[model samples]
Target chain A: MNGSSKKYWTDDPEMVERYVLGRLSEEEKRRLDAEIAECEPCREMLRRETLLAAGVRRFGRDGLRSRLRRRLVRERRSPVRMYQSVGLAAAVVIIAVGVGVYQMFFADLTRPTQFGKKEIVITQGGEIGEAREEKREVRTPEEKMDAPPPEAKPAVRSGAERNVRPAEAAKRTAPEPIQEFAPAAKSDAAAARSIWLLGTVVMETGAARTGAAALSAESRTADAAAPQASPDRPVTLRRGDVRNDVALRQRPLSALPTARRSQMGSARRVETLVETTGDGGLQLTIYTDDVAASELDAASVETLDGDSLVVTTATQRILYRLPPDLFTAPSVRTKR
Target chain B: MAARLFFLTPDAEILDLIRSGDEEGLVMLYSANERMVRVFVTNNSGTPDDAEDLLQEAVIILWERVRAGTFERNAKLSTFIYATVRNLWRARLRGMKREVPADLAERDDASDEPSPADALAGSEMAAAVAAALDRLGEPCRTLLLLYYWEERSMEEIAAQLKFANADTAKSKKYQCKKALERILTDERII
Candidate 1:
């Protein structure tokens, strides 16, 4: 035995056993401490017991402590910190459960009765008032109050309703007060038919009136009466053979360069019937032969009167009437 | 007092420092305790990758608990940290999404190596000692090992393993030693 083990052995057996087994009380520890300071035999015994214990402990030699330490250190630095909120976890569970329960039982409760009633109003045309009245009867007083206000309800005008078959049926059943306006209504209907026919004629004739053939006849008339006309006021009409000449002249041509003019000529040809307005600005009907296609590309077509000026592109609109010096490119221009 | 320090220290201290806002403290805390947490996780049946993930989760939980002032210090700092890691690993086990390999379930008892004197006795001697320990039965062996290896006090060992009192721990310890000695002498391995 070594000196410490021998010293421990020489001391009380109970004390040696207690210390060796690591069960020594504080008092026993203090006593051993005092005894070992003087006793070499007791010290020697302790050494032997410790060796025995050490041999027993080395059975499994894995570096579990160091591994554990390394693991602990790594865990402390992990990035999973974002998901650690218990409250958030609980809240997610609650929301999921709530949705599940709602789907299982209350799903049908959420469907609005007004949706069905609105469909009926649209399909049946003139029965909108009766449908709304029936809807009000079905709802409770509290539901009526809680429901959207009257202004929120969509107003369906009977006269403006299309699908004439349904409208005629509704009108036959309508009250006598509405019947009194039938004569006045017939006159209004006749006027609307006349306007529709006139629109078709004007659209077809405008371009034909400005053609070269018409211009030649006008020139012949002017030449026959040439000497009789006033000398001081010359009626000089510059008739170019170009398809877009009349429309181009009617626009502010100073803004458009030759390249853009040719592009406009090929991409779009405008027909205009110009009449002088009382305000001195010309009343112009600037029609594009390809109005549907050009409207898709252009910003918008605004009608001054019977004349509509179709701006062929967005950039040309910015240069309208404005001097070149005053035109700055808009900072945030959008094109679609 | 040490346990109190371990428990009472807000988990959120590092996070709060990170958020309000000390970026360095967050890094320091993360780097420091990461390995121990991983080992604890692995010991409790988590995969090596799972251990890594769980260690991060444990740290994050610690941070959140500290922030919320919810961490309760009931054990030593190391013990509490190990327990937290263990709890997280246990939760993963219960989830049953994946199988935990058998090797991870084995306890890592090798950290408590016996003293150099015991080591010099050779593997045969160590086996002899373990065989002696086996003869003492569960409670005595448990108390003896916990006393020597874990360095638990009589009160702590009694409370942990749930013996009657400190006196029970002492008597159990004496009996275990006597039993070990008899076994050793009979086997002629001491």
Candidate 2:
């Protein structure tokens, strides 16, 4: 082994490559390892190769480990836990579907049949009764004279009172014989009232109106009721007709009242004149028809002092007296 | 019978006992090789912190390989452990951006009790060696340094720097050594 000329175990290129990648056969590796013990040259070669391989591996490992660790942490802290989460979600979906199926097929089965039957009976009787009342009211002129005066006066006056004062018309038509007619008229009036009540309830709860418009109506109704009950509460105005008007009004009010003279400052365009109150509040008078009752905020009352009402916000410390009828009058449309 | 068997069995039996998930084997291994691993790491241009890190890494590798039944029994356990430490050091060096100085190769000799010649302070031989290395071109300097410091084989030196073959690497190494010797002789350090 000392005088051996074969350098295959010494400086062999294939042997070096195998050693570097750690792919050498056990016997070959054993021989080389033994030779390395006696030979400094072989030892040195092995050291350098080992260093190079380690360095490359370290670089690769550092990049790979960071990426893998991040992925692992993300997976661990995800919104849903891994194992049972899918099953739980599937179960919830199944339950929802089952409930939907039951509602589609057997919903009416759960309702009381007797109540429906009673409603049908009442509806049918109501129609016949209405017809009978109509026939009785339309009797011949000779028999019509026998009809009570209370019933006759309301029917005649309601049509003719437009031309005459209501008090004078009612006085001329009133008679003692009309007492018995009150019950029939009351019943007819009750039926009409119930129809409107049912319509209102359906509009409130039923799935008829949808999208932004319906939501706006709901918000408006809520706002009207809300402020009357509580004054200091914030008013939530959904984007709608009322909101649009208020927003349009607010734009001009919020605008910096510039001294620049333009169409806004012109006398003809200024339909409403604002005057400051003693407390630095404003008074506005708009020359137009009455504003709608639906548009009023019940919590705040606009007093009709001529045609204007004083408005004030303590926080703003600015007073605005605006025309009560400004919104009602035809004016330049302001964009919100 | 148990006493006789225990007496006949070598310390390897005790080591096996420790190796079989035994705390004793871990203690023994750490006690024996910790310093060697640390020295190997430190001497190879690693800081004390880096030494500790490499030592731990090498121990962990050994423990895992042993546990996995992949550790071959050809080499002595200490030698195998040292080899592992050396491999780790080599790896760190290769990974470094800058080349390690060749003076690090002489560190082991420095640690041994100095000979009278070495003990004489500010020796001309040291100056000559430094001057010789400085006079050599970059290629020759690199070749000599890699040869002494890393103790790289001709084949490895060729492959690492992408030489065509081991013969070329050996020829270059021989030329660098001869040039270094000529400079030393001219400086009258040899």
Question: Which candidate gets the maximum TM-score versus the true structure?
Answer: 1
Candidate 2 local lDDT, B1-190, one digit each (tens): 5553352333364357434644345445554676787776667667777765565554444543454344556645566666665555554566675565564323221112311212221244444465557677777766654443334567777886677899998888777767766765676655
Interface RMSD of each: 9.0, 16.4
lDDT of 2 at B128: 43
Q: Highest lDDT, which number?
A: 1
Per-residue alpha-carbon lDDT of model 2 for A1-336, expressed as tens digits? 334575647577447645654556779878888888888767766654443333323322233234444544565566655656877989999998887556434444222112211211011012111111233242212112222233221111110001112222244434212110111111221111100000001112223222212223333333221111123332332222232112101111111112111112222222222222222222222211111122222213233233322222211111122223323322211111
TM-score for each model: 0.29, 0.20
Q: Please list, in the order the candidates appear, how each scores on TM-score for chain B only.
A: 0.39, 0.43
Candidate 1 lDDT by residue in tens digits, B1-190: 4543232354445444634424344345645666787666566655678765665544444443443244454544345445556655654576676565564454332122222433343456665676567666777777766665444578888997888999998788778777777777787765
lDDT by residue for model 1 (A8-49), tens: 433565556456644566686687778778767667667657
| Per-prediction DockQ | 0.14, 0.02
Worst 10 residues of 1 chain A by lDDT: A190-199
